[model samples]
Target chain A: MTTTNRQVRLAARPAGEPRDTDWQHVEEPVGEPADGEFLVQVMYLSIDPAMRGWMNAGRSYIRPVEIGEVMRAGAVGRVTASRHPGFAVGDHVSGTFGVQEFCLSDGRGVTKVDPAAAPLPTYLGTLGMSGLTAYFGLIDIGRPEPGQTVVVSGAAGAVGSIVGQIAKILGCRVVGIAGGERKCRMVVEEFGFDAAIDYQSEDVRKALREHAPDGVDVYFDNVGGDILDAVLLRLARGARVVICGAVSQYNSTRPQGPANYMSLLVNRASMTGMVVFDYADRYAEGVARLAEWRAEGRLTSLEDVVPGGVAAFPETLMRLFRGANHGKLVLEVAGGKGTGTVIGEGGSR
Target chain B: MTTTNRQVRLAARPAGEPRDTDWQHVEEPVGEPADGEFLVQVMYLSIDPAMRGWMNAGRSYIRPVEIGEVMRAGAVGRVTASRHPGFAVGDHVSGTFGVQEFCLSDGRGVTKVDPAAAPLPTYLGTLGMSGLTAYFGLIDIGRPEPGQTVVVSGAAGAVGSIVGQIAKILGCRVVGIAGGERKCRMVVEEFGFDAAIDYQSEDVRKALREHAPDGVDVYFDNVGGDILDAVLLRLARGARVVICGAVSQYNSTRPQGPANYMSLLVNRASMTGMVVFDYADRYAEGVARLAEWRAEGRLTSLEDVVPGGVAAFPETLMRLFRGANHGKLVLEVAGGKGTGTVIGEGGSR
Candidate 1:
C-alpha cells in the first residue's frame, strides 16, 4: 500500500480559464479508516466542465469548491482499508472523492460497483454520474418522443454523447452538434446518431434546418451561447430545452443568454434546468438500465483516460474547456488495468 | 345605420418604433352580413402590446396583419345584423373585429359578452384576453405557492396588474415592477400587491433584493429585457419564470436576451413561455373565476378608455409603447356610459 497520498488543491479562483498557478500539489501521509469510515485508493478521477463552475466563488446547484480545499471531484476507486459495514477491502466503489490518490469516506453518497461486470473506469463514466446526468436530464426533462428530432450540443463530450445515444435508443431522430469533423463523424457513425452538425465549420442554424427539417423537439443543451440561440430558432411547437450545463459560458466574463428566447413564446415551449443529484434516489434504476444496455451491446461507454496520474489533474481538466478531450475525460490516478483499454485516440470502445 | 365604415389599415411594416405612415385611415361602404354571418357595430377596441408584434412581417403565435389589410384588433361590439343561429341582434359580443366601426364575422372565435353584468370595456380588459393571460400564465406556468415570492414586471399594465393581484390572492408575497411612481403606487395601494419597485426611479436588482429578500419564486415577466435580467439574478432555487410578453423588446430592432440566464441552471429553475390563445377552451372558467373575484371586491378591473372613437386608433395604440396608458388601454368607438368612468388620469379605479 502507498504510504503517501499526493493531492491537488485549489490555490485560487480563476477569472477566466484556470491557470497552472490556480492549483497546488502536496503529499500527505495516507490515514487509516475511522470507526465507520473506509479508506479508498482512487483509481480514476472524473474531469468535467462542471469542475470550472465548482472553482467559482458563488452558488450553483452544488456548493463551490473553496480555495485551499482538496479540489472536489467524482472518482472510482478500490477500497484499501474498510471499517464501514457497507464496504469491503478490494471492492470497487464510486463517490465524491477529491483529486487525490487516497480518499477516506463514511460510505455516504458512495455506491459499490462490480469490476467483473464492467471495466473499473466505466464505473466513473457511463455507469456513474455522467450516465445518470444524461439519463435523467434527457428522459425526465427532454422527454424525447419516438420519431421526434432530438438535438444535443457538446454531442461528443461525456454527458452529451450518452444523452444522444439514449435519445436514439428511445427511437428519436438524433442530431449531434460538436466542434470538429472527427467528432461529427464519430457521433454519426459510431454513436448511431442520425446526423451530426459540425459547428466548427458549418453554420449551426443552416445545418440544423437541413438535418431537422421538422424542427427540434427535444434540445439537450450542454453548451449555452450562440449554439443555444441556433437551436432556439429551430424549435418545434411545445419543444423542451433541457439545461444540462453551459460549458461555453462557464469561462465567459459575462454569459450571454440565448437571444432567440422569444422563439419559446412563438413555439409555446419551455426551457428547464436539471441537476443529476436531484434524482439521486433513483440512481440504481438508471445504473441497472444502462448496465443492461451495455451488456446487450446496444450502448457503448467511451472513456478518455489520461495517464500522468493525479499530478496532471489541473492540465487534464483544462482539456475539457479546450474541447481537446473526447468521450469521458478521466485522470488515471492509480495507473491500473483501466488505463490499458485505449481503443483509439477518440476513446471509442 | 351608418352607410360608411371608418377603418384603420396597415400601409407598411415599421422598421423600429412605428411611424405615422405605417397606418392609413379609410372609409368603406358597410357591407351587410351574408348567410351564417353577422354585422357587428364595434363599440370598443382593445389595444395591446402584442399589436406591435402583429404588425411585423413574420411568424409569431399568430399570423401578421397583411399590408393594406384592416388592422387586427380585439373589440367589444353589438350584433346589429345577425344571420347566425348562435348570436341574436342587439347582443353584445367580443371577437377579433378589425379596427373599424363595422365588422362582418362568421362568429368563429367570437363570444357573447354581458354588458349589464359588468361594463362594456371590461370585456376587452379584465374579462378578456389580458385576464385569461394573467390567469393561465400565473397558475399553470408560474405555479406560485403560498408564502412564495411572486414578482411581476409591467405591474401597472393590463396583464401584469392582474397577475400580481392573482399571485397575492394565492397567498404569495407579491412584488410589482413598473415604470413610474404613480404606477408603482397603484399596484401596491389599489391592486393589493405586497410591495412595488419603480423600475424607472430605482435599480430593479437592488429593489428586488430588498423586497423579495427570500428570492423570487414565480416571476411573471411582461416587459422583458433589462428587467428580465434583473429578476434572473434574484431567482430562488426552483423558480418558475413565466414569459407572458416582452413589451420592452417588441419594438427593438434586435432583442437583447436576458444575460444572466445561466441563473436558471445555477438555481435549477425554469423559464417557460405561454400564448393565451392556447387556453381558449378554458377562457370561460377564467372569466367566471375573475368575475366572482370582482364581485367579492377581491379584484379590481381598471380600464384606460381613450375617447375620440375609431379615428384616434393609431395614437391610442401608441400609448402602450410609451408606457403612457394605465391599466388596460381601450379605444372607446361608440359614445357610451363606459368611457364616462375615468376614475383618474392614471386610470386607477
Candidate 2:
C-alpha cells in the first residue's frame, strides 16, 4: 500500500477572491486508523460556493477554517482500512473528509453509501448535501403550496436546480433565474421549470414581474445580492424567502448589504437563513426521497466531474464561484472505477 | 332621541405630526338604522397609536382612511336601535365605529360585550383587541418557550404590558423596554417582568446584554428604530423577532430603516411582521383566556381613562405616543355614571 497522501491546506485567509498563494499543497505518509476510526481514500470531493464563506474569519452557522488546516469539504471515498465496529474495508462512505487523498473518520457524522443506488459523485451532488439542502430549505423553510409561484436564483447550479424541480413536483409554477440564456434554457427545459429569466440580458425585477404576474410566493435564494433585492420587490403577501447561500456577495471586498429589505415589511413577508447541518437528524429522510426521485427518473442528477487527482483541488473548487460548472462541481481524486459509478455508467466521464 | 350628533372627519392628510387643521368637527342629525344595520351611540373610544398608520396614503394591512371619511377608530358603544338580527337594542358592542357620537354597523366583525363580565371600557382594553394582539403576537408569532428570555418594547402601553405578563405566564424571563423609569418600574411590578430598560436614559444594547446575558430568544417589538436595531444585535440563535408595530417610526417625516438587520443572518433569526386583523377569526380564544386570567387576578387589567367628552379626543389620543398612558388609553366620551373609575371587573366587555 502507498504510504504517502497529498492534501490541500489553507495557508492564509484571503481578503476577497482566494489566490493560489493562500493554499499550500503538502504530502505526508498516510497514518493507520486508530481504535474506533477508519481510513478511506477519497474518490470525489464536493466544491461548493459556501466553501468561500467558511474561509472568512467570522461567526457563522459553522466555524471558519483556521490557517494551516486542511480546507474543509465533503467527500465520497472507499474505505481501505477500518478499526471501527460500524465500518469495514471496501465499504463506500461519505463525510466531511476535507480536500485530501485519504481521510480518517471516527464515524461521528459519516454515513455509508450504496453505489448501486446512485452514482458515486451523486453522493456529493444531487443525492448528497446539496440535494438535501434544497429539499429541506424549499419544502420545510420555504413551504411553497401548490399553484404558488416559486422563484429560484442560481437555478442552474446543484442546489437551485434541485429546488426548482422539487417545487415543480409539488405542482408549483417554477421560475429559474440564471446568468445566461443557455443556462436558463437548460433549467426550464431539462429541470421542468415553467419559465426562465436570463438575468444577464434582462432587468431582473421587470423579468420577475412578467414571469410571476401574481408575485413570488417562495424565493429559494442561492445567490443573494441585487438579484435578492429584485426578488424582494416582487414578493407576494406572506412570501417566504429562504437564504441558502449568498454566492454573489462571497467575493466582495466589503460586506454586501441588502438595499431593499423594507419590502419584507410592505409585503408582510419573511426571510429565513438555513444551514443543512441543522437538519442532520432528518438527513436520511431527504436522502431516501432524493434517491427515490432519481430512480423514478423524475429527478435528473448532474455532476460536472473535473478529472484530476488531489493537485486539482484548488482549481476544481473555484469553478463553482466562477459559474464555470453547469452542474455540481466535484474533483475526481481517486479512480472512478470501483468507487461507485452507477448513475454515470452510460454517460461521458 | 338626539336631534344632533357630532363627528370628527379627516379634513386633510398631515405632513408630519397631526395638527388641529387635520381634523374637522361637524354636526349632523342621527339617521335611522337601515335594514340589517344597527345604530350605535359611541361610549368608550380606543385611541391606539396604530391610527397614525391608517392615516398614511398607502396600501397596508388595512386600507388608508380617505380624506373625507370620518376618522377610523375602535369604539365600545351601546346599540341604540337595531335592525340587524345578530344585534339588539341596549347591547354593548365593539366595532370599527369611527370617531363620532353615532355610528351605524351592519353586523360585520362586531362582537357583543357583556358589561357584567367587565366594564364597557375594559372591552376596549385588556379583554378586547389589544389583549388579543398581545396574546397572539407573543404565543403564535414569538413562540416563547419556557425558560427562554423574552423582551418587549413599548412596555408600559396597552399591548406591550399584556405581552410581558403573558410571557411571564409562559414561564419565560421577560424584559420590557420603555421610555422612562416610571413606565419601566410599572412594567416590572405590575406586569411581572423580570427587568425593564428605560431606553431613553440608558443604552438599550448594553442593558439587554446585561439583563439577558444568554441573548434574547423572542422580541415582541411595538417600537421600531434604534431600540429594534439594539435588539437585533442581541438575538440568540434561532431567535424570533415579532414586528407587531413600529410606533416609533410612524411619525418620522423620513423613514427610519433598521441598520443592523444583518444580525438576522448572523444569528439565523427570523423577523415577522403581523397585524392583529389577520387573526380576527381566532380572537375569541384570546379574549376568553385573557378574561379568565383577569378574573383569577393572575393578569392585571390596566386602563388609563382620560375624561372630558369627545372634544378632548385628539389630545387624549396623543397621550399614547407621548407615553403618558400607563396602560390602555381609552377616552371617556360621554360623562357616563362610572366616569374616572378603573373598571376592575373581569370578563368580556
Q: How well is each residue in A1-349 modelled by candidate 2, as lDDT tens digits?
A: 4568899999999988998998999999886789988888888989999899788887677899999999999999988878889887777899999998888899988989987878889999998999999999999899999999999999999999999999998999999999888898899889989999988899998988799999999999888778888898788999998988888878877544455555675677888878898889999899899988888899987888888877887787777777888878888888575355322222221
Expressed as tens digits, the lDDT of each residue in A39-64 for candidate 1 is: 88888899989999999987677888
Model 2 spans with C-alpha error above 4 angstroms: A1-6, A11-29, A56-59, A80-91, A114-118, A229-239, A249-271, A306-325, A332-349, B1-30, B79-91, B114-119, B232-238, B251-271, B306-325, B335-349
Error of 2 at A15 (Å): 5.5
Candidate 2 on B1-349: residue-level lDDT in tens?
3646788888888887787888888888876778998877788889898888778886666789999888899988877777888887777888988888888889887889988889888888899888999998899889999999999999998999999999999899999999888898899898889999999899998999899999999999888878988898899999998888877777777655565555676677887777788788899899999998899888897888888757777777677767788889988765274322212112122
**Best candidate, DockQ:** 1
Where does model 1 sit among the CAPRI classes? medium
Cα distance off (Å), candidate 1, residue B31: 1.7
Per-residue lDDT of B166-201 in model 1, one digit per residue for the tens?
Answer: 988899999999998899899989999999999899
Give residue B135's error in model 1 in angstroms.
1.0
Interface RMSD of each: 1.0, 3.1
Candidate 1's displacement at residue A168, Å, is: 1.4
